[model samples]
Target: MINNKTIEKFREIETPFYYYDLDVLRSTLDVVKKESENSGYKVHYAVKANSNPRILKIISSYGFGADCVSWNEIAAAIKAGFSPSEIVFAGVGKTDKDIGAALKEDIFCFNCESLQEIEVIDQLASKQKKTARIALRINPYIEAHTHKYITTGIEESKFGINTWELEEVIKRLPSLKNIRLIGMHFHIGSQITRMSVFKSLCARINELQIWFSSRSIDLKIINVGGGFGIDYENPDKSPLFEDYFSLLNEFIDLLPGQTLHMEPGRSIIGQCGSLISRVLFIKNGSNTLFAIIDAGMTDLIRPALYQAHHKIENLTSAGNIYRYDVVGPVCESSDTFAKHIELPETRRGDIIAIRSAGAYGEAMASRYNLRDLPPSVFSDDL
Candidate 1:
């Protein structure tokens, strides 16, 4: 929530900036830490969500590990105070250069998505005379019931190794002498709100565990990749960390010495930050009032890319509410944020707050159309 004082501060600053409430972030982290600690589960903050240096440093301060997708992200995590020993690298299209870099750093684990990737990591590890720890990212074929672009566990997805290929993967693991297989990883999708989806994933993991045990394979880690969603309508409501951890504990059957891990991204950071923009113009569309904002898809692309809904608020107005089509200055017609959304009577220069933007907002920003990237403003500084 943007208080009156914060809204006043926004007037002094430039338009189209990310406002991060550090207190909100710390409170969310406190819940995550408490829940994970109670269940003895390890949490690796998914670095791909929001790799802001300050965000990463704050999460690292909680003694949480990091889950990175690229060598660059891994480097950023390390630079932000995340220990290399607590970082797990994951990606479907990891190049040899990245594999070599991760091997050199000796990161905690490589969430290998395919046999080819595992072979490449093995070769890279062999070249460096090092043993790379790996976890097979198996496709459980579970539907997370989220947006298609974010769903990954289905057979058609190009992410994890399919169930049909597991025999070959396990058969070939013996020949990859430079790599050690220590775990299994799964990421069904992002923005998953249904707890049943996680329950289904746990059932599949248990089945796979039995299969591995039948072959006398002793896996040491079970990483259920994160996709927990947040309440976009209620920005102040925290994520269901306690319920999520409790659900995992009840359903997943872990062997002795095996550790449970999660890679939460959105649920940890989504509510703490918002996209703050200034109303540049109040134009009338054919059928609706257009509150054109200075921020564009380049600043926060989730709405344009996924048609995601974010609660919009007019921070400076206290007049009677009216419906408006909140839009951006981007040339693309698809750059709309919310359509026919209710807001206080708005005018030019009114501050706008796009709630639930902390996850993929700044991290996915671009410089398209020659627009400069939006800057971040921490609440502490204000």
Candidate 2:
């Protein structure tokens, strides 16, 4: 729960900033560590979520590995105290520089997306006289039932290696001496709520494991990449970690000497943070009220892009209720945060908290329209 006294303190700070409940984050991390350890699963925290330095430091202290998508994220993970051996790099378009950096750092593994990427890593590793460890990211074509932009496992998506190409890929893998294929990686989508979808993924993985074993390939790691979702409506409830883990344990059959790994981003940190915006004006129309705020799409784009819903709260008002189309000062009409939102009679100086924004919210912030990005504030004993 958001501390009322902390909400009061927010009134003194300028609006359009991120407010993180560090206590909630610590508790969430505790549960994740305990549950994953109990199941003998290794967890790599996705760096694309909220890479705030303080937040990353806190997470690193809990001893979670990192899952990075870019060279900068690798650097950030290293700066946050995560050892290079604990980092896994995954992305479709890794640049030459990025590959060189990963090879230099000697990270754990590269989740290789395509045959061309595998060749490229092999070449890069050969140049540096290093053997690159890699995992083939396979496209299982599972429909994650999520937003189209975030889904990645379908045949049409340009994310992973297609099924038909696996045989030829393995044949070619023996020729590439600088790269060692270690495991398999799969990421169906982001913000997925259906546990059944993951069950299907596990079944597909089971079949793939048999196919690999037939080719004399024994995988050391099975990385079921993260797509765990959070309850955007109820931020207080813990994420469905138990059901998520149990589904994998029940369905995913592991070979001897193989290890299970999971990359969880949103499920771990999405609900622990909120976007704090201050109302600048309250314009009244014939039947609606427009609560114009200082924050816009540049600060939090999920509401505008994905039409995502977040619980909105006015921390100061208690009068009669009214419907408001909460908007920001951006020039585009589609830059709205919420429409037909119900709140108490709000004033010009009230602070509104957009809840459940710790994942994509801060990670996707931009400097469009020349607007400065909002700073982050944490609830801690400072």
RMSD of 1: 0.7
Residue 66, candidate 1: alpha-carbon lDDT: 98
- Please write out the lDDT profile of model 2 over residues 1-382, one tens digit for every residue: 6668887798789889999998889889999988899999989999999899898899889888999999999999999998899899999999999999999999999999989999999999999999999999999999999999889999899999999999889999989999998999999999999888898999999999999998889899999999999998898877978889888889999998999998999998898999999999999878778999999999999988988888889988889999999998999988898899899999899989999999999999999999999999988842
How many residue pairs clash in each candidate at the backbone level? 0, 0
lDDT per prediction? 0.94, 0.92
Off by over 4 Å in 2: 285-287
Residue 313: error of model 2 in Å? 0.8
Instruction: Output the worst ten-in-a-row residue range by lDDT, candidate 1.
Output: 1-10
lDDT digits (tens) for residues 135-215 of candidate 1: 999999999999999999997999999888999999999999998999999999999999999999999999999999999
What TM-score would you give candidate 1 relative to the actual structure? 0.99
Leading candidate by TM-score:
1
